[model samples]
Target chain A: MSDVSSRDRKQSWFYTDIVKEHFFHPKNFMDRDVATDEYDATGKVGSPACGDELRVWLKVDPGSERIREFRWKTFGCGSAIASTSVASVMVTENGGMTLEEARALKPMDIMNRLGGLPARKFHCSVLCDKALRDAINDFYRRAGRFDRIVVEASRVVDLVAKVTDHDIEEAVLEGAHTLEAVQQKTKVGIGNPGVLPAVEDLIRFYREKYFG
Target chain B: MATRHVYLDHAAAAPLDSRVLRSMRPFLEGAGGNPSSFHGDGKEAKDALDDARTRIASLIHARPDEILFTSGGTESDNLAVLGYARANKANGCHLVTSAFEHPAVLESVGHLEKKEGFTATYVSPGRDGIVSADDAIAAVRPDTVLVSVMLANNEIGTIQPVADIGKRLKKLREAGHTKAVLHTDACQGAGAMELDVEKLRVELLTINGGKIYGPKGIGALYAKRGVKLQPLQFGGTQERGIRPGTENVAGAVGLATALEISSEIREAENARLIALRDTLIGGLLARVPKSRLNGHATLRLPNNANLSFLDMEGEALLLYLDAAGIEASTGSACTSAALEPSHVILSLGLPYEVAHGSLRFSLGRATTEADVDYVLDTLPPLVQKLRAISPVRVDEKYYV
Candidate 1:
């Protein structure tokens, strides 16, 4: 169901000119050559046959690892596009090393930044989190600066968050295998990827009730 | 009329025809009487009710005496399944049905299990949404008392191999399983597909009148003569006492009239609506990015276009379309607010992501190419807007 934006939709082509001056258009990038500390997260959300995909493309600096740039191309609906835009820009402006620096960034944060997207479109920001991490990794990988890649608290939290039996030995081994590698080692056949919540809860239950 | 509203949910209910209205007008006014009363008006109502029963019986190829008027498909389904199973519990306590059947049949089966102590073996249709009659027959146990597979599905619109089921039931009967009553909820098949009680080889058949351009709250269950079903409720000696209360004369007349018209014009109408429906559905796929069509396309109803717009919740899509003045439904109307998606869609084994984004546009007598075109012109951009803010729009690499 392709169509208009909320108040974003112009009453007429005459109203289109007014909308453009306020919001970004279907035109060029929003400040493609932006200031330092831009968020670089890329999200490709949907499939043409089934649904949409988004890629959050954000760039974090190697040394400071602060976000430097953010941009993306979205394929699904206007809500997805708007979500990506808000996330990319907010991460760029607020991203840094301090906990408070990126504190303002979240799905709701992204939504609110764009004068709020439809509640259904909140799922669009899943890519925002991943893109932010990938961008930081990409920046470090590009600069050839780091002696070793440091998997952050933010990135590691995606199912690999806990410092458990697996993470303890794996973390000491010095990037022997990626988090995905460890997950495969620990988990059985991949069923629902999102069943991570249930898996995490199960693992926690076993640790606290039995092992602890 | 110069203008028409989109009426695609015919499986849910059809627009009452002018002719059906014409036939029922007298019954609503001058012909009002208890068909059992000893009076001229009573005799007139009785004649009308009998005539309607005969007409319905003729259309479905059943004896008029075997036909029983019901409140609608739900009641007919309940009576045929639970009624038959409970009455014959001494012989067998088990029943069987397909997982793809409408809730009218499935829920009735569930009730039989819960209340009447009847065990139901629900046979699953594979991913293609087609149930092999062989599989249904295989699920039959020695204790199976009835097999109630729907003739056609209200969702995917797949017609079951009903005739094959009937023949198998006959074979089982010959081998001494004669107590197993074969019943089908044919509510979706009345106007969209063929219906013949004998041809389908079932002991009982259920159909709804509103689904075929007749009055609402009217349906019939064809329990073949001597099928031996116990009635669920005590009633006056109406509808041969199987279904009771004052006869709904207007509803009966309307249903009979609708059945005649639908039987006569079904083929031509199917061809026309199918063309227009296909054009609309096909166009939506081409123009809308990330649009997926749900259900078996060719095997589906003439006017159904079920779609899922990924990365967007179906509820949002329905809301946006409402603002755009195009009305439609997401999955079953009964379960829409639950955010659980349609069980019909889920039974196909599609993921929750696909299920949440599902939409069904059922075509009716009034669907037109222009209406579809108008929809085509309007729907895509709404999808684009919703998709923009969606988060899970990314790629994942999987290892085999």
Candidate 2:
């Protein structure tokens, strides 16, 4: 118990020096009113209603199949801004990551580059990775490579509303802990009793995954 | 180079006044024994405690013996809501309060509902952030035992119509329609508003030292005569056995001095703060596009200026302001450990995006016009930068 408490005390500061540096002095952020033709593809993720949103503008080299420029903007916390900033650097640094490499980039990689975030802020890192994948998918869609687009693994829980497991996870990350609370946000398993058990399992899984 | 520092989160805590500190110096320097002791030193301590109680009571126009000291606003609120409800359970098990009350009162009432078999109705405030007296009174039933509301909201600083609510409740009692007692957390109002217990007609009133430029960790609850309350803590007879513990002598002294000083200078200071608050609010609205003020325009506390900028999260804005040496607060979920935005902002029927985008700048005694202008000059660029980065469009309306 003492060991855990001492470790927590050492990491009490909300942001690391790197995170602070990135948040205060972000890199490669797109300025307001950038020409639409400047970036080949743009992808956005998260919702303003959830108190976080990220938009990534990607300029990919078609011949090399590598990311040439990665600029982004976010309406989120310090951790979200810093994570996106650092992730932008990670993908575009040293001749930039290939499309495949960028797609394989995980939230852990961004967190590792950030020297780790608070347990609650782990979800913020997840947003940037998802947004980067979305940008990659957008690039592929624009290139008419429909087969190259990688869809996220999400099961539809609410058939009528098409609320997916990803929606439930996002709801949980937004502080909906209980079944009723999660239902309020996503409207999952309400009138669809057959999916109730699955929704419960997903809520438990998400609660442990992000919170623990 | 040293950055220019400007403090604007006075709603969180005010800097302790040196005069109040001087008043508490004797107690801190070991001038007397505990008030509970029977020795000569103890008698001196008791006298000092009595003096503090008298001065504090006089500030609110209550009898000296009606004042009960506790650890702080939380404890006083807990004692009033929990204590009063439990003691009068035989009378009624129902309570009424506003949806946007401080967690101290809300949690206590919640505890009663969850664990103690009590029922409660939480009346939501209007979009203007004022809890209508009619709505509050309408929620009170014959079985309602207590009603808790705040004198002034700590977030948006909208003043509640507790006096009007209290008068209606009194009328109900006179007509034998209900037996409910009125309570108001006046911690935020103690520094600015005239807190006459007679005019407010609150049976239980809570005032904290921290908000009035006094010391922290000390608060008093004014319980009208003949009001029944069960003790939250068990101990020897102290605070009439309702709040039994060793007295915080220095804290009491400091709180009394602070309240006295605040009462003396409130009118002039309020006028000055109103002008500055208006300048800050008006300047921000003019300079920053798609910004709207939160809470009532003219009915809010003189020092509070809460505004929401579109398409940007408040925590990120606060961080940029902090880097620029401007201290403020936010209603963003990211700022709190609970990951929930400000309940006060949400209680106004605003959307989550608006709540997430809210910022509060509460000025205090040492605030100057230059400080307000500094914020005016600093905040616009920061908001623009954040908005430029935000995915939410400037032309889109997040809330209807």
Candidate 3:
């Protein structure tokens, strides 16, 4: 276990050099002591007990609602830290993303930018987009427009396979008819027995509404 | 930054002792014939193997014939658990193990439960990461055939009451209540604690080379006389056909020499490590707020200093420490490939966040007072910087 890492200088067991770089020298990371009044919107996703927690704060131009600056703080592993760091930089680069555009940011987009995370650590990337959406929702929440909040459910459907409800839904929509078919596609509920009922329910709903 | 690297991850892998290397030189540079062959070179190799076995046996106070050599700690643990359990299935079909055993033991027992139809129970350790003798005894049933507990944990370094459990099991065995064999993975115990097999009362014990100051790819299982163990592999009749492969004479020699040396200086080295360990723990707890030790205060390995700095990821701390010329670990080196927090840490009733934030700094023979002082000086600011950037917050400071 311990001697495995000394083999190649280019790669560690779980992280690439780029991922390590972002983890150690993250960009657009805010000091933990930053004032609450410094940002127009803030979002938080995950909990400390879950082993990954991320908070994103945004400075948005009022008329344009364009994110001028983005800063994040993460209480998580290397992937979570690097993913959020890349997300913070991604949103603010090249004249910044609009609030809607930032809200639409996906975890894969951040993972792709960070070069990629290990298969087991792919769930860490989910924190960044969830936190970004949380920040966007926070912006809308603060402006008395609660209806504009884009609900992004980051609840894991399979902790082992790194599957989510969104992934199961995507699999169901792609014409995976049976539980086995959906499981084969997404691997959701394969290792996690507790998520089976929810996965089965989602499969039934999607199958009846779309294929019935 | 210092040019000399301070290695604090001895529990993961210790640097090989020069003496051990010297002991293996003749075997390595010579003919290196197969121990099973009948030629003169083979006889020389066979003699070397026998001598090494005798030396290793003396380290644990076991007979030479009882020690079965294997690939490493993983193989030895696997052989002890799977080999013994499968061989004695008629005695009973139940097995017991702690939840915090190395994956070698945990996974081997898990396989038995899942595929082999053997019933098993995982005894959870207490908050101090110590598996009490009573807890282990409570899990024992009339049909319980085997109970595999570690001598000392690899991650948190909590020294288990293996001998106490063994004593209780011995009573149960004598009373005809159960026919369970007591096994202890003493890989981490070799250099840090006593490995007297009779004193520990363990029927089967596992020890490895790399954890001590020896070569890698070599380990031994001490199966007490009359303890039945089936072959895990089938090939040449090496290691009494239980391990079933041509033995590495050089590796065996190195392991034996290392074990002999480690056993010889264990007490003094343990004393030195304990001082350095306590100083490191005290410094970190005093300087870093919201930090706490992971395992039992006094019952832990003298070389182990496992501490969790709240509000910071252990991987982050490890990287920063590496850049600062200090090498350490977050938890079990085996499980670090996954993002999930250490199961060993979580088994202590700690929350997942606390497990994720834990870091292990195990001292070794090469560790010096200056090294401890350097870490005491380097860690606080790094922790403060990480804490400043951390989103998670805690109010009260924690200590062991």
Candidate 4:
């Protein structure tokens, strides 16, 4: 108790040293607004309404198929900021990773590099990788590599609302744990009894996948 | 460590006053008898407890016996809501409270509704963050046993129209339209606003020691004379059987001293802090782009400045401010264990983005012009830095 009080008085760090380092001084971060033409392709995920949003700008070398420059901007908590910062480093370190290698980089790798994030903050790590994948897809789309572009698997859950299983999963990741909560967030399966089972299954899957 | 440390999270907790500590030292040291005992030592302890109770009661213009001490604000709120509603269940089972009440009150009402077979109505505040008294009173049915609206909001710092609701409830009772009793959680308003219970016309009022520069873990609930409350605990016969357990003599003395000091200095201190609060609020709005205040312009507490910066999360801004030696708080979900933004900010009909980006800086006795100036100088750059990295645009169309 005494040790805790003394540390508090001294202003102890709220996160791990690595997280603090990255959050205080992020790497490969775009600190100023840049012209859209500067980067080859940009990927965006999440929304400010969801309490977190990430955007990554990637310049991939066409010949080597390596990511030449990786820049990101995030509006999120400490964990999100630190996770994106380290993910940027992981993708761009040592002459950068090839397109396939970058695509293979996972949230777990970023979490491991940052030592570990708080349990509740695990979802924050998922965002940067998703944004990075979006950027990768953007690269493919811009290059006219239509066949190479990967689309996330999702099924429509609410026909009227156009809500999908992926939307339910994202809602769960944003702290809507119950079916009703997910519906409140994404309006999934509302007034449509047929898709309740699928919505519930997706909610349970994402809750266990990220939380358990 | 940063060279300048400006503590602005006073609404969360304040540093204990030296005078209060001095008043509490005797009870903490040599005077160790329980107020429940009948021996001489116990008599001395009981005297201290009674004196504290009287002082606390006088602060709110209530009878000495009406002040019931508890562990803190949460417990006091729990006892008032749960105890009162349970005891008065025979009269009615319906409850009414504002949507933005502290979880202590909200959870108790929720428990009554879910676990018990009671119904409740939650009245939301206006865009100005003020709970309308007419709306609250309109929700009070004949079966409504209790109507609770906080004296001031903890997050946005908007001073609620609790007194207006109290007066309306009194009129309803007189007209035999409803049996609902009014309660106000004055935890955030004790030191900054008038506490005369008669003027407020509230049957129950909760005040916490921690927010008033006293020792933590001590609070008092002012129950009107003849108000019936079923005890939440049954360990002892203390607090007239409303709140059981041996009295916290040291805490009681500390709270009394702190309340007395606050009452004496409230006027001058409020004048001083209001200047700092306005400067902080006005300077931030002028310096930062796309920033807006959260609570009512002039109806908020004298020491509160809650603002939302467009296009960035509050937790990130709070961290940067902390790194710059400016301690503060936020309404952002990331700062909360439940991963939900402040209900108070959301109650004002704000969008999730605005709620997530809200920041609160509550001034206190220790705040000064220099501290305010330091924060004014340090915060604009941090907001700019965060905004540069944020994907959301600052344009008005974005919010639309």
Question: Per-residue alpha-carbon lDDT of model 4 for B58-128, expressed as tens digits?
Answer: 88899999899999999989989999999999779999999989888999999999999889999999988
Q: What is the lDDT of candidate 3?
A: 0.81
Each prediction's DockQ against the real complex: 0.05, 0.33, 0.34, 0.35
Instruction: Give per-residue CA lDDT, model 3, range B1-400, as digits (tens).
Output: 4465888888888899999999999999988988889999999999999999998888788899999888999999999999999899989999999999998999899899999999998999999999989989999999899999999999888999999999999999999999998999988888888899989999999999999999999998999989888888898788887888889899999999998898889888888888989999999999988899998889999999899888887777777788788988874221254434688887887765677678888889989999999999999998887777788885453333
Docking class for candidate 4:
acceptable
Candidate 2 TM-score on chain B: 0.98
**What RMSD value applies to candidate 1?**
10.0
* Residue pair clashes in candidate 3: none
Q: Candidate 3 lDDT, tens digit per residue, A14-49?
A: 677778788778888887577777789888766665
Which candidate number maximizes TM-score? Answer: 4
What value does DockQ give for candidate 3? Answer: 0.34
Where in model 3 is the C-alpha error above 4 Å? A1-21, A32-38, A116-119, A152-163, A168-212, B1-4, B332-335, B395-400
For TM-score, candidate 1 versus 4, the one ahead is 4
- Go through the candidates in order and give each one's C-alpha lDDT: 0.64, 0.85, 0.81, 0.84
Q: Is candidate 1 or candidate 4 better by lDDT?
A: 4
Worst 10 residues of 3 chain B by lDDT: B331-340
**What does chain B score (TM) in every candidate?**
0.94, 0.98, 0.97, 0.98
Q: Using TM-score as the measure, what is the rank order of every candidate, best first?
A: 4, 2, 3, 1
- What TM-score would each prediction reach against the true structure? 0.68, 0.90, 0.89, 0.90
Q: Please give the TM-score that candidate 4 achieves against the real structure.
A: 0.90
Residue pairs in clash, model 2:
none
Q: Which candidate gets the maximum DockQ versus the true structure? A: 4
Q: RMSD of each candidate?
A: 10.0, 5.0, 4.4, 4.6
